[model samples]
Target: MTGLRVSVGDVVDFGAASGDRNPLHLDREFALRSAYGRPVAHGALATIVALGLAADREELARVVELSVDFDQPVLPGLTYRVRRSPRGVEVRLGELRVLTARWTLADRAADTAPAAPAARGAGADRPGPPPLPDGGGPRVLGLAELAGLVDESYAYRVDSAALAELLSRGAAAGVPDALTGPLAWASFHTGMRTPGRDGLLVGIRLRLTGARERPAEVWSCRAEPPLVHRRTGMVTVHAELDGAASATLTLVSLLRRQVAAPTLVETLGTLPRSNALAGRTVAVIGGGRGLGAALSCSLAGQGARVLAVSSTPATALTREASAERLPIEPLTCDARDPEALTTAFSGVALDGLVLAAAPRILSLPVAAATVPECVDHVADAARLVLAPLAAAHELLAERAFVVFVSSSAVLEPPAAWPHYAAAKAAIEGLAGHLARHRPGLRVVVARPPRMWTEMTNGPAGAAGATPVGVVAGAVVRHLLSGPAASGRPDVLGPDALSGP
Candidate 1:
């Protein structure tokens, strides 16, 4: 099959159709703050697209059993393709398999005979909160009410013209297509009826019994008691559909861990009042969000005039700094553009420079990563680091210091983050080279552990992550104490923050 790209419009349309309006797949700001760093396509939408590309209309209509395993989130703007495997079909982004599916087709022909539509119900469009494992009973929803939650017409448009035609034909035939209403309902069942708001669906198993001759008007869905695993925070729910069509499905989902936004007050309170950096002027690249924001506050609190340079405007940071009367100025500049960086710092003389800008962290295994994927990540990091350093050279004081924000992942690489680890490792090497080449300059490399930031806000991403404020405090304190005596770009590990 040709390479297919899922666009933001596609994701939004699917959400309208599937009633899976989880902010992770719809809201850009919400997604940016979540672990994904951007909006993602729904797993069900991906599954349907894969199925449509893999099989013809007849095969899809005769599907008796289907199972899909979501290996990774299907993000928009990336080209994906469907490959027919020995067992079924796999949806891949570059070399990485995002979803895998297998299905069993019934040998017998589908029953096309029209039958009486089931009685329709007037249940609430938006149902109450889903039941937990320890409390509440099952939720019984009517087909009309469930369908009303999201646009069912848009569900038919899963990017395949043939699939959409088949769905329309099935609707006209008075049959509830297994791949349309029922498929969308499965998403609604997990996202709304079982795990509610925080659910991240990981896998699905669906079994279709005898085909319905006609669509059931008042079809009812009942979710069995939920099974929540405390250790893994995984919730498994079994839902059974009855009325005109009979089917059973199992959905496995994980609850996302919420990471609270760091406050300027909390961060400033963590550091002691010291004038070690007094009268010094520090320029912090990527100082608008995450660790950069915390560092800007910490540095300003310690009596340094800080230039918070970022690609985007840091309105909130600027407002907070103003209210607190801190010597922090927010400057918008793309660090990748040397001219822009130079222009942003034209008149300022820097006593110190902190390279803290980086791309969003994503999990892509080495085998699945293409050369361009790795190169792009490494290139982005190098540009963010090198451009600022070059721009600051003409503005540096006689004894200026430079701090390169590397990562612990470089020392102990993650299997799923070869690109990220490689980029950090390359920059760390550059820092060491710069330290050795410039004998008089003080260069420090900080390898901080996973911290609570939008970049690491997913369930697994936020797990055991250190607070950004805590790490910022340590980094500020280190700046005051000076670099190690060894002198070849004094590298600070995770232990540097573990004060005595």
Candidate 2:
């Protein structure tokens, strides 16, 4: 416990220094007009003091989540003490609580340890919800709407009055927490619809990213449709402002209780046209790895002539192709080298391109990484994915499907892998731009979560990992779904994909 003596002059000085000139905090006359009879220090002032108290007691990591309620205002010229307990920190005035707060502590060990690998091919064995007779219930949002949901480059803005009000509340209460209320309301109305009147809210989770506290005259907002779980009626909605996540809301509601579980294939309206790529040539860039290997096999099995490119010599791919009697050719190409890539595929025309190769991942946190290291790494990633498009444009057939295999880390960036997240963000931006400008090219970016692969062979990967074959199958199905699937989404994941 720590005690601090605060005077009226101290409160006034704090208000001036913090740019919080709210009359309730600084002006006795103005404060008298309000419900509180005397001058009261800003609620944030109490929170700041409490936070300092909490930091002093322990070796502070990052402050993950902070929620506080100001039940009573603290009058100036009084001594207030901040008490820290296991549950949280609190500010009290001689036994009367002024403000109460709770915060989530970060795990120090997670930053140093490798993530555990999830169960291999976990999604395939798990039974999906039973398929509905007429497909599923009415979708909360349309396929096209959800597909092109997030455009990080788009410009957006919040109203000036709204921004000011939020800032005032945040300055007074220690957070921009009030801002989420409106955002949540807008999101619910725009993206959600209850199937039945008896539906009840079962769960809710909210996360805030410390981006900007003040809104500009105009700002761009990026959002994606809720990743709905068909059986449990769980939905996750994400929103970002100025390229950073501002809020992520996860909700579980008692909605859509049907005997048959909804399958993505049926929800998308039509089944894929079979043998759609019977005569086409498709290239898998990272064909040596698990998911890429599965995709190479799947595409060839579907009658597409497959070209498998990997940094390592694909002896296993050749063996698999020969055993299956499929038209799969293995070729070695350093995706980072434009010369090697162009030389390897100089003459072969392509109808589909799968960009899936990732560099060796370093477990260092973003803060520990050097600027040059990240720049050079991201440079290679961009070159590998984009260079193929320029080199093969002339060789690409009209309406050629271009797919970039991305990761779910772009959505929830891991503390230890910021570089991967940044690079993937750049890739998604590139995919979105290409989709808008290149009408003749079909672009699909697949971001599968926690697939059991060499990349996910550590402690963190051991939970909720989808099977490689399941993801691979979904990718092929999307490709064969005709023009409706083209330029439809910048990225797709298991949430939006169902098994074959």
Candidate 3:
């Protein structure tokens, strides 16, 4: 898309607006001593830049599947550029690192005559910020309105490296100043930093490789007022993805986009601890692995007294709690068997219960009836284990949330693992019934796909698993958000298990 660039000040502002005041963005002192040797940039800024790039194709607001990673941090004085295609957008700094993301166009209502929204990245390229409006009177443009995103020609894939170089030149030309460069907003109030009344955003221009590098299609993105980007003058981008590096970590964050105030911080005059889950006793089943473990960590980190459990106790998972010195009781019990489950959770006057466990599910060629052993692998395991453990959840505390580890596999399965798919489908059905029938116990369900676990990857790895850590975080968020919270089951992919 055309006219897709961002500024550092805007990136900072967006981060501030989002209330993500990480030291990396706010503390120069901390940044100076860190690995980058200077304050590094927030990756979300790249997301906003990606959105800016999409603006050339369509309004990015309608786009989703907007995933990305911070190949390396963006530091001061570095010139950068945003490039896009129907398939995706890239945030790059010359030959250095860049974060990429997918986008799409959707939801534009076209009419009989002409549509209001412009789909192509053709339009008047908004230049650097105008000098303070004369006498504060209605600000007017100095140049005639240039052709804005009008047709498909402007919509071309971009070459990240070339675009970055162009931006460096433009940065030198002073076409866009530092205030208009890559930046994010983290505002305490919506109007804390008003942009010329209507929230006029200053757009930044770096450079682009334009065309040949864009994606096949950017989903659900459309055109609209470009008020989010500001300019940051081009500086030499020193950070790189350490060229020798491979297998970079993907980052998924709710911190990227704007969030409601209450979601960020409690209302003013409200003591922070007033809302803290401090002094609370929460029961967590499956707390020893994957999502359960992640939830346990988040809660325990919050100083909550967490009672974590799993199908089989793992020393690594249990020690996580002890390391934090949080009061956590990791237990080994068959949750479907009421007696053992209840006895394990007996002493706690629980306020919340999070069930985030799935019994032992080993993916064998269970469909090979020729080897009755394969067929019985799942069937034998379920009848004596999973089914009984599920029944045992009846012993949880009132207001408890029994979060069964469901599976997205039920949505689709390949030809090989028919048995595993059927079992998971039945588990989901059971979870649905519990959710619908037992409203009081707060039966919630989480379905994350194959996660990155010692059991799921590498040469010995199975076909469809993700990182254990990432899956855990998704589960933690689900369990923490109460009934009033969105009840949709959390679904994560393999990435969700490993790391972002």
Clash pairs for candidate 1: 118-217, 174-215
Model 1 scores a C-alpha lDDT of: 0.70
C-alpha RMSD in Å of predicted model 2 compared with the true structure: 23.7
**Per-residue accuracy of model 3 over 149-221 as CA lDDT, tens digit each:** 1211112111222223333333311111111121222111111112111111112222111112122211111
lDDT of 1 by residue, 158-225 (tens): 12222243333323222235545556666665655556566778888888775567554334666666
Name the candidate, 1 or 3, with the larger TM-score value: 1
Clash count of each predicted structure:
2, 18, 100
For residue 287, model 2's alpha carbon misses the true position, in angstroms, by 1.3
Best by TM-score: 1
Candidate 3 regions off by >4 Å? 1-275, 311-313, 334-336, 359-398, 458-466, 482-500
Local accuracy by lDDT, each model = 0.70, 0.55, 0.40
Instruction: For each candidate, give its TM-score against the true structure.
Output: 0.76, 0.45, 0.38
Candidate 2 segments whose C-alpha is farther than 4 A from its true place: 1-274, 460-462, 485-490, 498-500
Candidate 2 lDDT at 302 equals 73
